[model samples]
Target: MHDHARGLSSGAHRRPLAVSLALTAAVFAVQVAGAILTGSLALLADAAHMMTDAAALVVALFASTVAARPADERRTYGYQRAEVLGALVNGVVLIVLCVWIAVEAVGRLSAEAEAEIAGGWMLAVAAAGLVANLVAAWLLRHAQKQSMNVRGAYLEVLGDLLGSVAVIVASAVILLTGWTRADAIASLAIAVFIVPRAIGLLREVFSVLAESAPRGTAVADIRAHILGAPGVRDVHDVHVWQLTRGAPVFTAHVVVDREVLDGGGAAALLTNLQECLADHFDVAHSTFQFEAVGHEDRHNAHR
Candidate 1:
């Protein structure tokens, strides 16, 4: 059962990586052409977003492949950290693009360049982009639930979807009101939407790289739970962190009472402690050091 589940998850991860790459490639081509033909800031901004989408998809594909590599002597935890690194790179790139878009939008807003928008053609192309983005978003939604790397790619695609919608609205406004500033307004809105999301992703990836505890999992709570176990006299040196997006690891030194320590009851107590941690904290990887009274020197050495 475990093997089958792992196989299914592996296949699921690969499928989205492939689909996202292909979709982003196609979307980029369409967006580039739209930008050239319409001369619309909104279209240009969408194209920039599509470029990031392609880059993000490529990073996600690479990360997923690297993450499947087995642990080696040099990399005790394997290549799983590659996904966090990829997400960090993608987040930084998105922030750069957002800043560029914002700067360009502000310049254009001040000068108010009159866009030579081919209203019908612009609308048609934007509608096509909207449909493509929606389809890509749908294809990636399932995979996003399975991995954080996929989720980052999924969010980029969703951002592109909003950019497409903004372009369509800008085209409509230009057609109806002959107002060129609407295009710049749409571009500004797109930048506003993307920057905060990029910053949020950056923060999360940075936390993972720093080996900080996973969000919502408190160290003190874990310590309390371990100490609450019967026969446990004290708990110290408790460490908790994420091994991957959803996989958490924990380690600690647990001191048992002298009676429990001498009688082989310590092993069973440790097992119970492991179960309690798993049940309460959803921590699957746990390492507990059983200690007798007056063993601080040995415990310190082991640590």
Candidate 2:
């Protein structure tokens, strides 16, 4: 049996996300100017990704706020899924941004004409961007653990953080060795780092959109456990899924012995079944349709 239950931590996700958004917006402004002045493709790429990060963070913040509203009659589950949609949108933006960066880096690498970069300007702006990314990482670190919306934001900032480091290294290289190719190389490397993480995020977002069962949860195991409860003869139509990150919900048709139904033990049996899911599977929200063994099979029955 699981000893402790898990729940969404409230009011904290927004703080870090909002702080990160402000910092990212500031860095993007500086980096765009730096990119133009320094003529560094790597700086330009990092700045571009930061643009997406800022936009994505705004969506995530809005979703988190909307997700907190209580469920109403017209919208039974409320707006909790706003976070999921935000995550999907963020993932799509990351992929599109990555592709653009990759294309530009390839063009730069293949160009015949070479351009001299202002390494000093590139390095200064990149360092500042790196610092901002670090601050963003620290602020959002805890929130990412329980919230997919925050995790999407965290991953974007993390990718930009790595992009900043790559820009700084390229700038330093060009400063010392006159290696203009380092700029393109660093941009390509940044794309490399971003693609895989973006793919992973898209997979998770797609899972939620598809309404698939939460990863690592076995429906067969859950069925067997339900059947093991006292007076339970069968369990069917067992469905388990996450309403969101850290929240698992279950529903099933549980058939019981007719004697148990007639003997006034149905309430106790229902409690046992609900507890089974709660204690063993960490499924706090469960609904079981209990019926006598023969009742469910009686197709001739009328309402």
Candidate 3:
């Protein structure tokens, strides 16, 4: 018997992404203008990060829309995994952007001639970016918990927030100490901060794509629960994995006493198993194959 229990769709996060995207676009423009005016590598790096954040939000928004599509014959599971793909792209883009920033910062650091930095304009622009990132981060904070796509955008915004702070600090150091190298140092700091988060996000996206069991779900405990159910003698061939961020799917084979089938209790047994999965494991979709004792011997022989 198989039971399909639906969960909330990804569409709920669209508004947050849209709003964040608008804010990010505006910030990116301001940062780019500031970078050009101040000749500050740190400001330019933050603008680059903001550009990626804007792109990530756009991808996340599109993925949420695609993921909300209904299942059909050709695509029985629908488009829920689109969010995972969106996250993957976001992670890759962030890492690539960081690599570019790191190389540029190194070149600036090695140059003998100090690049003149307009500290006042850089500080003002970075402060504006900090405020915008804070607002965008607040908007997506909750939705990020529900969707990986939103989480990717949220992470990008957070990186941008840190980048803004780094730029502000670099501007201050330049303004107060007249140290131009601080601008390159701050760009390197932003790159260092972002790479770990991007790698972590990629690791999660890969885990989901690989169909590994969702984190925190114990397969052994789930098996024990199934064995504890009434009229079940043994269980095997268990599998559990997630289709997306919060949707877990499960399957198992059960060996049942012959009396349960002969006495017309199979339906009740299936219902009990479904309820066990839904209630205890929070597994909304599950499939169980019931068989008489010694069936595994035959199944193994065939295998």
Show how many residue pairs clash in every candidate, following the order shown.
0, 0, 0
Which residue ranges in model 3 land beyond 4 Å of their true spot? 6-8, 296-303
Which tens-of-lDDT digit does each residue in 183-295 have in candidate 1?
88898889899888888888887787777898999888887887788888777777777656766777887877888977778768867877777678777578777777677
Which candidate has the top score in TM-score?
A: 3
Q: Sort by lDDT, best first: what order?
A: 3, 2, 1
Give the per-residue lDDT digits (tens) of candidate 2, residues 1-303.
Answer: 121234433435887789899999999999999999999999999999899889989998998999888779998766767888888888899889888888998898889987779999999999999999999989989888777888888999999999999999999999999988899999999989988998998898788777778888888888888778888888776777666666677777778998998999888887777677777787757777778887774353221
Per-model TM values vs. the true structure: 0.90, 0.91, 0.94
Better of 2 and 3 by lDDT: 3
Pairs that clash in candidate 3: none
Deviation of model 3 at 209, angstroms: 1.5
Which numbered prediction scores highest in lDDT against the true structure? 3
Cα-based lDDT at residue 284, candidate 3: 65
Each candidate: RMSD to true structure?
3.4, 3.5, 2.0
Worst 10 residues of 3 by lDDT: 294-303
- What are the clashing pairs of model 2? none
